[model samples]
Target chain A: MCTTCGCGDGDTRIEGQGAEGWHRHADGTLHHHAQPGAHAHGATDPRRLRIEQDLLAANDAHAARNRARFAHDGIFALNLVSSPGSGKTTLLCRTIQALRGLLPVSVIEGDQQTRRDAERIRAAGAGALQVNTGKGCHLDAHMVSHAIAQLDPAPGSLLLIENVGNLVCPAAFDLGEAHKVVVLSITEGEDKPLKYPDMFAAADVMVLNKIDLAPHLSFDEAACIGYARRVNPQIRVLRTSATTGAGIDAWVDWLAAGARAAARSATQRAGPRGVVA
Target chain B: MHELSLAQSVIEIIENAAARDAFARVRKVWLEVGLLSCVEPDAMRASFEAVSRDTRAEGAVLELVAVPGRGRCPSCGTLSALAAREDACPSCGGYGLRPVAGTGLRVRELEVE
Candidate 1:
């Protein structure tokens, strides 16, 4: 279990899945037989069941469905992940304001136990739905699937998913977003990318938020990008201050480009199967 | 922790396998865990125990086979061993080490009756 969202399972293959390299004693204990199928009572003896499966198979399947649905609907979804107090919501609200109906923007807010972020997003003038994770640290694909069914976001629209403000757990779960944008406030440590490598490693864009206060703080902007590049060389870096609306234009332009690309790509195929129309 | 949920998922897989393979009892589970992946073996063990209570997988031994991370250097196209995500390529000493392997969590085999 992770201190933040949750610990995730990785993918691995175990050898000797056949009727060999395993055994069970009449009494349950750490015991093993050196040979395969040594017991004469073939039906009664414990058997080695070959079950090679991924722990996240279920979640990955759900994410694949979500990804297909988003592509089919032409929805450009972005999953925002960051540590607490990175101003993710403020930046999202301001981004909503900046778009100003350029594209229908819908937000799905993930919080452990509050509707505050959803309310803030709704107040900023966008269709917002709150998915409180309760005791859970981050949102999962099943939750997003439900939210998508309810939101029914229009085609060629923007779906901004504000993942729970926790860096560690959200990295493991894929919500079928087109991109994962990680927000790190300038007030935070510049070594965040190295300290939380998993989050930085998973993100596509590293947004340096709260840049308005950089003049007063000792934040090293270049070093942060450098660290981010070390983990993910292809990650695009962006700086913004959601309060003053500074640098929001470039952010919007990025979003517009993605939205346009999504629309163009959506028209090229009939559905997830890639059937040309 | 999502590990708790992941542990639950393991049980679900085992139970599904039980139905598919017609097994009633499980003695041990062989799990291949990626060394670079986010999963912690100790934590997963505890969580698996906590979630497997009263289930067909109760008291099942989980043997973890560690898979080390492997990276490929982009500049020289040389494959190198990776201990961590921030590790520099040993062959080229370059920062652009693309992850080629590791980071997996899967149930490989099970000992059952």
Candidate 2:
């Protein structure tokens, strides 16, 4: 019985049977009081593994709902994931410049405390919503919904969710994004994807930003691309230099195309399916 | 590490579950740590121990199950379990590595009594 969701209270299904005798108390309540030196049940059991998968199924159901909501809103949302100081905000600034007059764009910036990224996005002439996670590491769907309510984007808008600078936890929580854009800089080694494959696998597009500084660093472009491709062959890789204005057009165009596709699908889905005539 | 926060989230989830299920204490937690998720099992274990104290999950045993990183080698048409972060195909040393699974973390199970 979950106090928050009201879905918890049920029969007792202990992981291992006979580890210790489960007694019915005076109030007819069942409890698995583990006793010392209890090895009555086998240590390795298959039922335990199935129970774990069931727990994950519940979370994935919530994630699927979020995905559908984003799709129905006709909004092209991208989750910007990366390590801190990997040029995520700088690339976003440049991307806003490239797509400002072309599309109806908005941003949801996640940080620990300061609203610096939100301020920067606002200064760049875009609607910005800031979510201060406090001690939270990743942004869940509930936080994203709150951020969306704050942004108040009109129908058919492009929402860029700049997730907290983390390559691990953010991948677990879906932000209802059509794409996950992982921004990696050349200063970071090419082995990043290999080390953080979950982030790379979740990302639909990989932006190898700060390419202008590639000449000064020992980071190999070929190795980076290879490593990213190894993790996600379907991921669209783009090299951009915010300071140098390189590959900005491609990024903007990709975003525009995604927004258009989302809008078209949303319209098509909403039109039929037994309309209320 | 991000696993610290993840462990915290797992604790919160279990606590909530316990509160609703009329369970006073959490006996154990079964966690699934994906190989490609970048969540160090050691870090998660340490964080769990540090945060679970004085809570519903206090002194609860953490059982970790490692999910193998299974990927598809595009060039070789081989699906294999990746022991580490090596993207190269073990048999053919191919470059085309496509992750088929093991890219996320989950709090799989909880035992409460």
Candidate 3:
């Protein structure tokens, strides 16, 4: 019955499909109370109940479980979010290639169709899996959980979940990611952060992608970053051009630090092995 | 855009609560929706009506309570009312405004029989 949170079992239906309900008696006797709705004979009258429950509780619960799994394995999971044509794939390929000798990397590509992104990731010397969400707009925690199980990413490795290229819906679903990195391209204009404030605010890091084109375009880097900061004061900004290989080293360096921290956390959970101070 | 899916999840919550709490029908619902959340009330109501058909929450009077967003200025450490995501700090006129509330979507209460 998944008797955990309110959002249990399935989407549309209740857990118990048997037309009978369990009954309890005062004399310590148990019996089956037949009928689904007509339990009004035993039911109470109309009343208001305070149920402070999140609408996405089911998804959150799944995300919590996934978070626990990642923590156990010392995995630094990242959910890369952005609009279409934000150079997310190119940035991923660049990072994957750069991270080759440092750590083992696994990619979970989310899209409405095709395995092209997954292929690109695999070509960059990393294990990759493609999850086609069909008509689903965002990648929820349940879907990511399944992907992680299938990928079985190595302990203390990096799991980059490239979400479906949509700013709105992806912000509403948490996939148990350690960080949500939003990539915005120079061609997308500085007003993007203002236009899609929810996405910008939800992200922990904002990657200003395709920065090599800044000279040719009128994109205001300072203004763009300022707008992002307005919504998210703690968001860190990184400038990178996935094609020109500029700033990729800095991005990888930051990612390596995060991965190292994750590994240390895992080791600490297993009790400290003394060697150096 | 995801309102339809959100409505579907709401139905699931109602159905699960009904089964667990032994309630047959839900008469009313007080839904707490954050102002900063990118959800349209008209869209949510219309979608809820469609998804709640024949379910426990069918024909339920779904009311939305607008929860105001709050943002804090990083420079001056002043908190201000954030009506939307793009709202700047009223006190400092600074860019770094961190959100503290009004981003949650929850079902606050339900009238059941």
Candidate 4:
């Protein structure tokens, strides 16, 4: 049995389906037979049962471990995903500044190069860890695990992982967060969520940032919210402008509530067994 | 672009499959890209060629089957073959359209030697 998810079978042909592969038996009960002229060709057959699982499977396992670790440590983690220049770092800085006194906040900023986002977060008076993905486009579970170790926030703390500026790959890899929040600037089209449903579907919250520039731009807040709802009905939408501190309080309150909810769940899980008197 | 990473993932899956199947060379790859997947197929193909160089899948033809976005329209039932801008239901013109399919990105099959 596979230990990680306990769903692994020996069958390599059908991933998560059955376990049929080369087998050896002492009593000759069962064994897979080699195909005819197996050694004639150097390459494997293309029609062989596809036992190969997703390449991100390992990263997913690590993400699960990170999730359990965060729960055990009473840490509330949020995975923030968005496109480039969507103001994730700017919104994060403003949020950190606003929520610094309410609760202990930490950030894990991801980028292709430079610690500019981390520097911005630090300037806002919050603990920040920069994760440079180098050539990679997204932040995986292992990277977040390492960054968490570096942040080392106190129990009942909030940690935000700002994923690399990409909407697609980051959505495929979960970073062990209580919630996945997506930031969209007003400059981006209102139909963005419609165009990128998977990312919006994966997100638990959607922040429409840069509302201050709404008048200067052609962005429609209602249409954006409508499209976001169309992609994910359960998504909580928040409009904000870091430049003017607009809607900062509501976003901060939402973060605090999220942290409290996560901490409460962790405490309940650690308290006692289900059978109570 | 993120499509590069996705193409790399497809290569990994195919390579691992080849190793198990004992195939040395892959002739072609067929992939199903859903409209809602947000992956640009052109970019993905470019990335596949660039990253698969020198690998078992080098020079392999990447055939993409583009699947139209599927959606569940609140005004109607399941809808398919939707136009890029029109996500509304055909019967009732309701705007509540939840995607039902066309969000998958996977290597469906491989022709190997």
> Over the stretch A15-87, how does candidate 3's per-residue lDDT look in tens digits?
2311112232333222221122322222355687888889989999999999999999999999999999999
Better of 2 and 4 by DockQ: 2
**lDDT of model 4, residue A203:** 92
Question: Rank order by DockQ, top first?
Answer: 1, 3, 2, 4
Candidate 4, residues A1-277, lDDT tens digits: the string is 3222222344233121111232223332222222322223235545534342544566778899999988987888999999999988888888888886789999999999999889989998999999999999999898998988888877899998999998777887888898899999889899889777778888999998889997799887888888877666678999899889999899999889988887888888887799332
Give the true-structure RMSD of model 3.
11.7
Look at candidate 2 and tell me the lDDT of residue A57. Answer: 45
Off by over 4 Å in 1: A1-45, A270-277
- Rank the models by TM-score, top first: 1, 3, 2, 4
Top candidate when judged by lDDT against the true structure: 3
Task: Mark the 10 consecutive residues where model 3 chain A has the least summed lDDT.
Answer: A13-22
Q: Give Cα-based local distance difference scores for all models.
A: 0.81, 0.73, 0.82, 0.75
Q: Candidate 2 chain B, which ten residues in sequence have the lowest lDDT sum? A: B33-42
Candidate 2's TM-score:
0.78
**Candidate 3, DockQ to 2 decimals?**
0.28
- Cα misplacement distance, residue A93 of candidate 1 (Å): 0.5
Q: Among these predicted structures, which one has the highest TM-score?
A: 1
Which 10 consecutive positions of candidate 2 chain A have the poorest summed lDDT? A14-23
